[model samples]
Target: MKLTTKELMEIIPHRQPFLLVDTIEELEPGVRAVGHKCVTYNEPFFAGHFPGEPVMPGVLQIEALAQTGAAAILSLPENKGKTAYFGGIRQAKFRQKVVPGDVLTLEVELIKVKGPVGIGRAVAKNQKQQVTAAAELTFMIG
Candidate 1:
């Protein structure tokens, strides 16, 4: 299923400026999700990340993937209204720079889910399919 930003707000708590995902292209409950975020020069972080050569931070990329994972769980009726928090991250890798004008494609797959805690593997890639970052993330839903 696909979800718009407005419907996404009903699940995830992030708001403008902090909400990185603009839309969900696909979602499979208890499995995986694909989301998109358009990075523009007008972003607030562009000013400080660097003036001439602005690059989206690797940490933020991972966070965006995690946020998508959270949305995946929250979109499910069984997990609605739950707050997902970062639990852990492993095997994180940053392969390329993500800059303004890049359209980020976030992919997150659930690894495990036990009660309110879950583990997922996520990756962020640019439009060219160059991976910007990836990690194994654990989240607690409460």
Candidate 2:
């Protein structure tokens, strides 16, 4: 199923300038999710990320992927109302720069979930479908 920003908010607690994922294009509860973010020059981070040339931080890209993963896990009937935290990150790679006007596509698939801890494989692509970032993320539900 697909989820709008509003509906996504009901599952994950991120908001405002921190809510990186704009929409969930696809979701398979506890399995996988695909989210999108429309990058714009007006993003608060652009103001200080750089002076004349702004680049979306690599860390934020990872967070966006985590958020997509979080939405998938949190949307599950058993995980509703819980919060997901970053437990660890591995094999993270930033392959390209992400700038304004780029629509970031984040895809995450849960590889393992046991009790309150989980791991997901995540990848992010730019509007051109070029991989911008990728990583294996660990999450802790609370």
Candidate 3:
């Protein structure tokens, strides 16, 4: 299923300027999700991240992955109204720079889950399908 930004807000707790994912192109409730983020020079971070050369921060890429994972999990009926807090990040790698005009494809699949905690395998790719960032994310539902 696809989820618009408005419908996504109902499942995930995030707002603009912080909310990274612009759209969820694919979803399987609690299993996985594929999201998109259109990187633009207008992003607040670009103003200070670099004066002349603006690149999307690696941390924000991971956050986008986490948000995608959160949306996947929180969309479940049992997880409605719940919040997913980052428990940890492991083996994160940045392969390329994401710049203005790039469309980031964020993908996350739940690898494990028990009670209120879970782990997800995530990756972010650029328009050319080149890996831009990747990580294993752990989360706790609250």
Q: What is the total number of backbone clashes in candidate 2?
A: 0
- Winner on lDDT between 1 and 2 is 2
- All models, RMSD in angstroms: 0.8, 0.5, 0.5
Question: How does each model score on lDDT?
Answer: 0.91, 0.97, 0.96
TM-score of 1: 0.97
Question: Which residue segments of model 2 deviate by more than 4 Å?
Answer: none
The TM-score of predicted model 3 comes to 0.99
Candidate 1's C-alpha runs over 4 A off are none
Q: Estimate each model's TM-score.
A: 0.97, 0.99, 0.99
Clashing pairs in 3: none
The stretch of ten residues in a row with the least summed lDDT in candidate 2 is 42-51
- After TM-score superposition, the amount by which residue 71's alpha carbon in candidate 3 deviates from its true location, in angstroms, is 0.4
Off by more than 4 A, model 3: none
Comparing 1 with 3 on lDDT, the higher-scoring candidate is 3
**Preferred candidate (TM-score higher): 1 or 3:** 3
